[model samples]
Target: MKTLLIVDDEPRTRQGVKKTLEAWSAGRLRIETAASGVEALEWMEENPTHLIITDVRMPELGGLQMLERMSQAPTKPVVIVISGHAEFEYAHKALQLGVVEYLLKPLDKTKLIHSVEKALELEEDRLRIGRMEKLLDPKLLEAGQVEAKYGQHVRDAIAYIEGHLQDPIGMKQVADHLHMNASYFSVLFKEQTGMTFSDYLTRKRLQRAKELLAQTRMPIWEVAEKIGYQTAKYFIKVFKDSESVSPTQYRQQVSDPEETIK
Candidate 1:
């Protein structure tokens, strides 16, 4: 079971959220509430919370301030901000801080439950990926035995590809960087990663583009530019082919206020 920490100043709001989530979750969740940001921070320090749903306006430390404080912790908790109509700026700032979700006041039960579900899904995905990367690290280190002569070059090339996935990445550029022929480098990369370099790069770009579309109100063209697509039309074609939906529709589906985060 995942633990959730709810932070809000109002007694009725806290009770309402707790009741709603408890009913919606059907007893699958464990929830704790704090009356203010200060209390929330204290609770976090003493307990482990996978997700936090906080009100943006509080008496002492506000939701954003609590988030900033959490940034310094060893394991930062994911946050979702609850804001009223007057605090739109604070909500936007929370989004910029990579908040998992933002809810308006007079919270809809379905939307709140969906946001919680989505946050948990994202958190689980992150943990699973972390575990996979850890397991891969040992195998990557062992690869040094077979490719001892070219190990460093291979590592550098992989690093470069990861760092520059949003840019135009070509076999020629990687080959030139490693002082090898394009054909030779292509074969080497495929042998190492079990996937073609072009395929790997495309997957990385699409992953990033999906994140941007899901989390922001950025236009489709802007998302394409951010993910290294020089033409929006081409980007749309590729995204649709890969995802079975156009970028706009993908965003709409994933960004639904009432949808779960999975």
Candidate 2:
């Protein structure tokens, strides 16, 4: 399900928009509303919202200021800025901040709906690219780069596997990439590496998952998606089976190692 946020200083505008969107896209979207930028940031820290449709003028931290802080976050939500002010300066700044759309107040329901749909689509694409790009992130696999222990072919296979842990990869895919018969490649791989290809792949994915869980504030579903798990429930089961702890528990432990020990 897609998640969206609406931020406005006025309670009426915020709740009115939220109800309207809920009525329109109740099942497809999870809509949240905030009355200030501070509340929005707080919500964002704890929740993984997809799109933020915000009012430009707020009591304390304005929408642009909120977005500026959000830009420094690990994951940024797609944004559509709405304002009652018709000034070009506000629109210019909102666009400069990478807003998907900037519309004057009394937002047209039609335009707002279109902008919301567009932002949601963009967020899906953005997350896919982000996950794919993290496939070969050296930081995630820095400690696992011990290919010298294997033969050249096995080493190459290992590299390929690491770079595609987020993909639907199996021994056959690696074998095909190496231009070798799948059965023969499997035999050679285990002979040289001391571990079966499937085991090795799962180990690496779990290793990557651990790194992300420990080092980043990504949501559990995003972490699972990034490491090739197709669903959050499956990811949670696998992680618990492997580590004897749920992903969230592991993150909490690592986040405060001293407290965990105590």
Candidate 3:
């Protein structure tokens, strides 16, 4: 089932649209309503919906501004703009913002149904295409081929980890990314990499840290943050433990070839 949000300042219009869509959906759609664009945005911060039916004009955060803010979201909902005939010019701008459908005021049931179906269909297509792209990501399939110890699934998981090394990524996140059970992913990861997930992540982060220390002049704390460590002290401790030297010492050694030779 898909969730839809209706945004209108008028209570009658909001509830009317929600009720109509609910009746037509036959449990296929979960309908929600907001009296204004501000309320709609507040609801969206907690619950993301598949589609939004928004009036073009409202006081205190109009529909266009709300759509602008939503553009920065990691996943954006399909939008259908509702406008009075006088607001036809504003509807054109909504189209520029990628509103999927432009609906006129005093909506017809048949047109509303058609637009809703089309928007949902498009949403499904977008999701399917996204999954397919992730599955067929060339870099994901290509990494770790030199050892061939891990299967494609493990390789894909590794790719996700590497790509998101800056984030506070965890084993569960990688497992979810690969669509596997956390425990099962842990076992498979150990079998394929010959190390626990934590160890592998630590090793990778250290490796990245070493590269950055040698290749760039970024501060130690910044490097730690970039490589997913929350604090430089912890990163330095781990680095010393794993390499028998602190990050500073390693950087000095790698940066000065003559000192290393001596």
Candidate 4:
């Protein structure tokens, strides 16, 4: 079972969140509670925790400070920070701490659950990759057989996808760029990358959209358009489907709270 820690000064919040997470995980997690960040760190010294859900403004050794201490460790736990205050400083500090999500309280159950699920999924991917690397030569993995796995057309298609992510390009356009039939290119891409052309393109666009959202205080519509989204509404829906949060919410979780974003 994966270990998860809940840190909050409030007794009710600590118990309530613990219960909600227990119900959501259905016994998949070994959940523990701490009344303060100091207490949390004390317990963590003897335990291995995969995730932490912490309140930002505890009396002594606040969540961010606890995270700063954790950062010096060999491995860092995935963290989700919750605060009653949406002060720019808290959000900014949480982002600097590499928090998985920053939530404003009173917590929404759906949002909390979605955030936890995403954090765990990412942790799983990290651990899986770590294990694979442990079992292989690091240099060989760094050299990456992924390129050797792809055909020249697929590589060119990937290059095209990366270059034209800001453009409203489609599979037909990309296939025509390589002077190949659309149907042939589609099959080749799927066989090579194990993902459909549309899926690959969407993934890349969303990745760029995330970076832009986090790094720049751009409006949602502009961010969407820059990633080939024609409309903000459609982009919001697609982003929420993949990320379990709207673009606005994701931006809120990651961006500078002092700077208002449209």
Instruction: Give the whole-model CA lDDT for all candidates, comma-separated.
Output: 0.78, 0.81, 0.81, 0.84
**Candidate 2 versus the native: TM-score?**
0.54
- The CA root-mean-square deviation of candidate 1, after full C-alpha superposition on the true structure, stands at 15.4
Error of 4 at 194 (Å): 34
Task: Output candidate 3 Cα RMSD.
Answer: 17.5
Q: Itemize residue pairs with steric clashes in candidate 3.
A: none
Residues 1-262 of candidate 3 have per-residue lDDT tens digits of 5789999998878877888888899998889899888899889888758899999889998898999988877678889988776566687789888999888889887899899999989887776555334223232234345446668888887788789888999999899988899999999988887778887787778767877887789999999999999999998999899778888887776665233212
Q: Model 3: how far is 259 from its true place, Å?
A: 50
TM-score of each: 0.54, 0.54, 0.53, 0.54
Q: Which ten residues in a row have the lowest lDDT in candidate 4?
A: 253-262
Model 4 TM-score (2 dp): 0.54
Residue pairs in candidate 4 whose N, alpha carbon or C atoms collide under 3 angstroms: none
Q: Please report, as a residue range, the 10-residue window in candidate 1 with the lowest summed lDDT.
A: 131-140
Each model's Cα RMSD: 15.4, 10.9, 17.5, 16.8
Candidate 2: segments with Cα more than 4 A from true spot = 136-262
Error of 2 at 225 (Å): 24
